[model samples]
Target: MGRGPPVIDFSPFYGQDKAARSKLEDEIRNACLDYGFFQLRNHGIPENIQKEILRQSEDFFNLPDGVKDKYNKDVGEFNRGYERLRSQNFEKLTKGDLKEGYFLAQDLPLDDPYVQARKWAQGPNKYPSEVKDPHLWKKTVDEYHFVVSKVAKNVLSVLFDTLGGGHEFLDDFCDHPIAVLRLLHYPPQEPDASELERGIGAHTDFGAVTILLQDSTGGLQVRDRRTGDWVDVEPISDAVVVNTGNLMMCWTNDRYVSNLHRVVNKTGTERYSVPFFFDGNPDFLVKCLPSCIEKGEVAKHAPLTVSEWMKGRYADTFGGSQEKTAKEMVEV
Candidate 1:
């Protein structure tokens, strides 16, 4: 395989020719099984939407620290609102990540059952008010979330099909997915920065899959499962990187890889990236697939809901103290 993640043309998946679609499916399946990461081109998201969101990201992050702090995520909030630089440390032993970010998910109304129940990561997003055009900011972010979510679901459908399961296998599971979209900005590291300092530390994603849109300033790296070497995931214009996550590995009985990845921005220029984490329905049980289990081998993990798994992961990354009840103040 090439030094970086494989690049796959995703347009054929939507085409009418079954043979072509199947060939692409094989490529996707292999990517997940081997590299656990790949880049997709012609994935259907509009170019304008992509460009607009990045523009919005830069604008929001450029605002004064005081203005951005108003929307800072609360101590207990696992997702939503802004998080300051060095607020999170993904690698337990390393320093806090040297990047700042904004988090958002489906803007559920206060009256929604999940919101009422205070489900983890189930709530409305907190948008910054200081932006030049607050309305446009919200609109662009919401539009990107809507379109990218569809792409994520399509990718999931193909993954299910590859495991001898039908496309509808994950239909209900995706209905109210625990999706979170993060807009991140990584400042240039000092020339003599400590090895422990990172834009974001080496860690596997906690969800089912991630779709990442990165700017030209690239420093992302993925660990090669075979050789245990970290390989760069360079920027590809108009293409988004996709990677498998821990939940996917559990569902497939570890047949699919969920590789470790991290970022360290040595590039002098600022780096920005948007990553959409599609973790699937909170209540959906993640159990091993029959096809994934060998003839005599049994499933490796006990069945659990998506929420349970996510809660533990958030606690691990954000610290146990940060885990608390969802906010009482709700937005429609």
Candidate 2:
């Protein structure tokens, strides 16, 4: 087989038996080690839910720019809402990303003081008035979120176990989680243009984990950790791509890595990808896991609340800094 990005058959992991399941886990581990990315098939999220989410996303993005702006995130720290074309920083190093995104996040309770406090970082979502059916956007997207969150829970459970932690290790951290699903629409690039320079830039996700569902038009690329070269990450219908994020690396004591990826307009057609980014409560303390640190390298990171760490990370993210500060945790 050609030594390109490792493409494994992940269909067996969907509701499989212990032996088969262990094999799948091994594949996930190897994928993380060798490629830092993998194409997953039959991952157990329903097809209808995925379809509905995409359709609603298309409907929302198709609306006029003015109509979409009504939902622009006003939350104190969060940029969750409608980010106009070229507004996001991922494209700052270049011209801009050729995509527009609608961000939806978990709605905080009305009486919660933190909800009132972080008006910039969190708030209620805004829906487009042009959505002919009032419930179409919310109903579909909310249901889609519910389903994916369930999948995230199940997968993270297994991942923690793989890291030498018990099955319930990640359970408490994400019980009442804060997550966002980005609805992205990437338009086709003109002929004879350098898509890599104009399309989505190479970057790693900021949350704990991200599950991406992409349409047929594939422009996604993932870096091969061993080779240090970029390789295409094509979409398999009925499949979703799962990758580690910054917080997870911190939580795991750097045992696993958060992969770097980007999207280029290569299919000669427009593209869309919905990524649900999941993480623990912003206030949760993030410390290194005992499994990763050994006898020699001393833990260097001090205790930092997830919220505080993320605030600086988010600031750097807005400024387009690729380097993230990894705090080593003190041994428990």
Most TM-score-accurate candidate = 1
Kindly list the per-residue Cα lDDT of model 2 for residues 1-332, writing each as its tens digit.
12444455555556557887787778777666555566666667789888888888888888888788887764434566787776555645656667788888766565666577763335565656678675877888777878888778766776775677565546666755667888999888878766455457777777677889999898888876667777777678867888877676676656677777788786678788899888766666767777767878654456566666555555654565545454422110
lDDT of model 2 at position 264: 76
lDDT of each: 0.87, 0.70
The model with the greatest lDDT is 1
In every candidate, how many clashes are there? 0, 12
Supply the global lDDT for candidate 2.
0.70
Candidate 1 TM-score to native: 0.94
Pairs of residues clashing in candidate 1? none
Model 1 lDDT vs. the true structure? Answer: 0.87
Candidate 2 residue spans exceeding 4 A from truth: 1-16, 75-78, 112-122, 192-196, 300-302, 319-332
Instruction: Please give, for residues 1-332, the per-residue lDDT of candidate 1 as tens digits.
Output: 23888999999879998998998899999999898999999998999999999999999999999889888887445467998988888876766889999999999988889888887789888988889899999999999999999999999988888888665657888887899999999999999888888999988888799999999999999988788788999899979999998888888988898888999899888999999999998988888888888888998777888888787777767766555222111110
